[model samples]
Every structure is written in structure tokens, then in C-alpha cells.
Target: MFKQIVFLKRNRIRKKSKLVKQVLLLSFDFTSLFYTLLVIGYFVIAIVMEGNIRNNIQDKIISIEAYTVEQFWVILTAIPIIYIIRSFNQPGVIFSTAEYTLTFLPNTLQQVWRVVAIERWIKSGITYLIGGIIIYILSPTSASIVLLYIFILIGLNVLMTLPEWKLFQQHLWLKIVVLISLILINLVNLYLKSSFLSILFIAILFLINVLLLPRTFQQIDWKKVTAASDFKIWNMVMISYVTKIKYRKERQYSIWQRLSFWKKPFLYKKSVGYNRLWHLYFEKNIGVCLKLIGALFLLLFLILFIKEELFFLAIAFTIHSSSTVAASLFNDRLRTDLVQMLPWDLTLFKQTILKWIYSTSALLLLPIIMFIFRDLSVWTLIHVLAMIFSFLFLMPIKIEKVFKKFDNKASDFKWTEIFCYILILLIIISNIYLEFLIGVCLMMGIIPILKKAEK
Candidate 1:
């Protein structure tokens, strides 16, 4: 049985390794792959032994920092703290549903635990082993730091079975007390600035969890255990043979949502057609509108306050909003059958949206941006703004025109292939120049592709 378990585990590891190998070989050219590997290897080596990690790296990798030993302790401490919290919610071991089933039927928790421990070690053993060796080298006098790393890894694994004991689950006060006690240990260590004391407390915490695992195995919540491994669907299908599992409760709508004007129609005339239709969908799911608005507001905030991130945010929002608008229009087009039949020219819609975006919103937005940032260029913002609106205006028309070609021929997903060309063209054009010249260049690039695809 143990050999069988090991064989199954080995196969999973092999499949993952094979997929990664294929992706690396196929996706990138040799020169690009070679350079990327060199850069990654340099950083990995730098991180592993930079001045023996007593001090943080001082480098040009802006915003990201490599923490010193003292700071890393806090970050490392978060692991045990996080697992303790997780143990409350999930006491399920990291076995798959099939593995869980097999282990439950034939093996004692201790016996199965040893197998799992071996698997866990196989997965992360070398990584922590290297870490332990480094800690030992750094503070050879403090031998307990090596044990600290070991116990931390073990405790993380053990705490997943936390709720198998009432000391954590049924007793809410006890759990809180345990959490507070652990936190206080950190506090005392911080107050004293004692590395030895912190290491001692952390190791002791993990040791306790390691001891608790087998004792509490009989009290394991099978429902939560199965749920953790996502076995509920299987349980539902085989309801007679397997026990009924309680899944997560359905989402409850807030009182404000129930009472609010979600279902109320937009105050627009019937002639609005697609405009009214889109608004109706947005109204029903107003979160979409609110979220888009929130993102726009966040962009404004980032520009004003976090100026360093403004360019990155602009690029992100441009790409994100472009995809979102394209997706929304595509989904909404499918929803409105009448709108699809109507002669809906994107040129008019583009002009209308651009009018509001370029004139009204820009007038209000650019002034505030200009006031706060005198040195910063508004060119990037204007460029991204134009690109986002271009995608919104172009891609649907591109898709529509592609589909029209298939009206005569046998309908196939050749339009999807055609749209890829249009998308790539727009992206390329937008990156170089930000103007209406995009339309002319776009038509020049697209007409030939359309003709070839139509053939």
C-alpha cells in the first residue's frame, strides 16, 4: 500500500515536470530562454548568500526589498501563525480524494502520517534543508535556529489537522487564548530582541502541533477533510455509497441590495436600443459599473499620490479595461438579439464615447493631474486612454465584419483567428503612435488579412 501511494505520488510529480519541460522548450527561442535563465540564476544565487543574509540587499530593483535576518524572522513567523489560523478552518491533510479514501479505509493516522511526512519532505525537504544549513552557518552559537526552521516546516504540516482536537474547534476561547499566547511570545521576543527566545517559542509551538496530530485523528471532521480535497462533487454523485458532505452555503445578498433600485429601468427613451440594453444589464449587475468606476478613480488616485506607480497603473488599466470592454460588448451582444440585427455602426458609438471621455472627463481629470504633477507628462495617460477606447470601438466591429464573411461559406471559427490579427495590429499600432492615424493603418493591415482569410 505504501509503495502504491509512493508510485501515485511519483507519477503526479513526473507529469508536472514533463509539462514544465514542454512549455519551456516550445514557448521561447533559445537566445531568449538562455538570457532569462541567466538573469534568474543570478538573482537566486544573490538571494541565497548575499553577505550571509545579515543585511538587506541594496540594489536598483526598485520597490522590492530583500529583508535582513531580523526582518525575515517576522515574515517566517507568519507561516506558523497562518497555519494555526488555517488549522481552525481546515483540519484536512493534503491528500487527494482518492488518496484520502484509501488511507481512511486501511491505514492508521500515524502510519498514513509517516507516508505524508515523507511526501512533504520530498516536495520541500531540500529547500528547508538548505535554509536550515544557512541558519546554522549564520548563527552557529544559536543551534536552535536550525531546529526553528525544521519545527516551522513540521508545524505548518501538522496544524492542518488542528480541528481534530476540541482544544481548537469547540473551544472558541481556547483557540483565541492559544492565538494570543503565540502572539505574546513574538511580542516578548521583539521587546527583548532575543533571537534565541523567539526560536525556542516557535519550535515549542510546532512541537505541540506535531504531538496533537495522532491523538486527535479519530475526532477528524470527515466532511471538512473531504471538502478540503474537493470531494463533494464525487460524494454527491455517489450519495448511496459515500456520506453526504455539507458544501459551502449559498451567498446571501445584503439588505441594501435587496431594497436598492437594481431592477429599476434606466431613464432613457426606447430608441436608445443597445445603449439602453447595455445600461439595463449594467443596472442588474451594477457591480460591473461600480467596479469600473472604482478602477478609474483608483487610477486618478495613483497618479496624484503614488506617482512612481502611475505609468505602470496606466499600462495595466489600459490592457485591463480594453479586455473588459471587449468582453462586456461581446457578452452583451449575445444577450441582445434585436441589437445584433440592427445596423449598429461602431463609428457613431466611438465618437459618442470619445466625446464624453476626451472632452468632459479629460477636461475635469487632466486639470487635476496637471496641477499635482507639473513635471510628469500627460502623454502616457492620453495614449493609454486612446488605446483603451480604440479597443472598445474596434474589436467588436472587427469580429462582426469577420462573421459577415462566414454568412455565405460554411460557418467556422475562422473569425476567431481573424480577430487575433486585428487585436495584434491594434496593440502594435497603439504602442508606436497615439492618433486617429491608427484607423487608416488598421484598415491597411486588416483588409489584406480579411481577404486572405475570406479566400
Candidate 2:
């Protein structure tokens, strides 16, 4: 049955890829995106602790040697606790409509359980594998430590998620007990401060859960499975999609309407062209800006206090985020009749200025962290300037004329911006003498071009 599903998936993917190629061949560059992700993966795996970098949690200036023995386990210990908390919010034994139908086939209940368990283990294993690789990168010791962590994580993923099963989920006490047991075990391990004892406790906990799964699986609630997966609603949506019956474009504002800031401040008493543009920017993007700021705060804490190695993740994040927000600044505003009724040249100029403001503002944290942690050198200075120029370049020079035509998808600068991103990221990572000179000249040239653009 699994083999049949796999074959179907492969055939479906082939057709989808053909359709995507026919549609997006001119608008996208798969190669540039692949290389960009490769660069990020390289940084994530290659990070190492060089010396006594300042850690915000341990000390203002703690040695990596000390942290290796003491605080390294702290990060590892929190992984299971995070999983426990997150599992509570996850859906009950989730199965798609397709998978739900498979249960009615001529298969025993044990066989069904076997297939679901195997598929889920594969999916969850991929997730845990990535997590383990990240922890390995962050570990100051040998790879054996991370390997044990990964093994424990695989078992714990099943154990922790068991609470979401019908037997445990309906009876709140069982769920609470499981949550407390896992949390207490980890907390005790922290107090004992012995790696051997921690591993022993985790192994015992994993065994208990493994023994309990058979009994729990016997009480499987098939109804809850489909309900959790929104089986009926999904079928309706598919039917609507196929029959060309479009859903309503409007979204309810009940939740957001209550937030004081969701209601815009008094920007202008009267609605002018600039006011309209400002309104449009906030109307569409303010929620994203606010959410991003909140996420960045958490990321800032992790990078500063938890692991300075995660600074590499921050750079990759900022590069992609700054480019995305900058490029999208004018997409919705200029693509429609939004700017048509307003003054064309002046509105274009205003939107460009707003792009510069928002993009530069989003990236202020990266440079700050860079200068604080890194040495105050000329290359560091050049790197920061290069990033800013590349961000500015992401907005095509010919954007003034785009989106004015009937064919909205005629704009094909997506790959050009992607190539610019790849070039800038490569230059930033390989900040050598030759690259530094090239970056300087590139920025110098871009400065005039941007000035001409503004004028």
C-alpha cells in the first residue's frame, strides 16, 4: 500500500513540475535559489567555536572551553522540553483524507498502525535529523554526544506526541501526567548534572512509552483522526477549486479589530496621494512588520544568550528577509490601479523612498550584531556596505515601467534579483582583498544608479 502511494506521489510530482516549468520558466530561477540555499546550509554546518566569545547568558566574557562542559548541556536539555510544549498544540494523530480512506481497505488494524507509524517516523526522522545536525554544529565536543541526542530525540518524539492521542487527549489528567513526567525527568537531570544519569533517565522514559503504545493504539479513535485533519472541509475546498467556484476574498477582522494599533493612527487628517500610499503600505504589510519584529526579538535572545554560532542563521535570515520585504514593497501597490489614479512620477518616487526606509530598517540589527561580536576592521565595514547596496539593487532599475501593462506577470526580474542575492552573499562570505575591492567598486557604481533612479 505504501509502495502504491509512493508511485502515485512520484507521478503527481512529475506532472506538477511540468506545469510549474511551463508557468514559471521565465519568472523564476531554480538554479539561483538552489545555490542560495546551499550557501546557507554551508554556514549552518560549518560553524565552530573559535575562542572566548562573549556569551550573554553565562558571562559577559565566558570562555568557550568552560561553556563546553557546563552550559553546552543546557541547550541540549531544553530540546525535549520544547518538544513537549509544542506537542500540546499539535493536532491528534493527523492523517490526510487519502490516508484516512486507506483504513477502510482490506487491511488489519495492526497493518494500518504499522503503515502510519512507519510513514510518520520517516517524516519526523527527517525533522530530528536536521535538528541533530544543528546541535552537532553547536556542540563543542565530539559527534558522539549529538548522536546520543538524536537517538533520544527519535524515541521522545513518539512518546511526547502520544499525549495527543485520543485516550490521553480526552482524559486531560493523562496528558498532564505525561507532560509533567517528561518535564520532571529533564529537570531532575539538570539538578543531578551527570550526563550518564541523564541518558539513563531518558532511556527509561523512552522504554516506558514504548511499552505503553500498544495499549494506546488499541483505543484509536478514527473519527477524531479525520476531524483533526479537516477531512470534509478539504474535500469541499478541492471541489470548489475544480468547479471554478471562488471563495470570498475578504477576511474577517474580529481579532485584529480589537488591537488598538490595528486601527491606524492619525497619519493624515485628509486622504492625499502620499497618505494613500502610506495607508496602502501599512494596510497590507504592517501585520508582517509587527510579527517579524516579535520573531526577531526571540532570535536576538537565542543568538546573544543561547548560542552565538546562530549568528550565521541571522545573516542568512536578514539577507532573505530584507530582499523579500524590499522587493515586495511595490508589488501590490504598483501592480494594480492603486498608483494609476495618483501622480505617476511622484508616487513612484515616494514608494521607492519607502522601500529604502523599510528595507534598511529591517536590517539594522544584523550590522549591530556584526560590529559588536566581530572585530572593528575595514572588511567588516565593506561587508556591511555591500549588503546594503545589494538590498538596494534588488529593486530593479526598470520597476518604474513594470505593472503598468495589462499582463501583470510580464515582469521577469525575479531571477535578476535572485542572482544579485547570490552574488552579494558569496561576496559577503568570502570577504577577501580582491572581493573587497570589487564590492567597493560595485557599491560605488550602484550609488550613482540609485541616485539617478531617485531623481
Best by lDDT: 2
Q: lDDT per residue, candidate 2, 1-455, as tens digits?
A: 76755764576468756654654565558899889999998776665344433233235222453554474455445565665554443343455455666667775555655566666667888888897676455544356755765666676666655544533234334544666566555555655667776667567657767776766666555555554454322334544544556443223243345456547665643334455555556656766765665576456545644565455346556656644564466555655555655545644554644554555365345434544444467666665566556655554433433443434545445445545556565554555445555755665565555445444
Scanning candidate 1 in windows of ten residues, the lowest lDDT window is 57-66
In candidate 1, what are the lDDT values of residues 1-455, reduced to their tens digit?
78768776687678656655665566568998789999999998898776544433223211122233455455455555665555454443454555666665667655665676566555565677776676555443245645665766755554443433334333444565666566556544544666676577567656766676556556655444555445322223333223334344224343234443544665654334445454444445556544665576556545644564344345445445644464454445544656556665543443333333333233224323443354445555444454444444444443344334325553333554445445545544554565644663555456546645654
- After superposition, the stretches of candidate 2 with alpha carbons farther than 4 Å from their true spots are 8-77, 89-94, 124-141, 158-168, 171-189, 192-200, 227-455
**Whole-model lDDT per candidate:** 0.50, 0.54
Q: Compared to the true structure, candidate 1 yields what TM-score? A: 0.36
TM-score per candidate, in order?
A: 0.36, 0.37
Model 2 local distance difference test score? 0.54
Instruction: Point out the worst 10-residue segment of candidate 2 by lDDT.
Output: 53-62
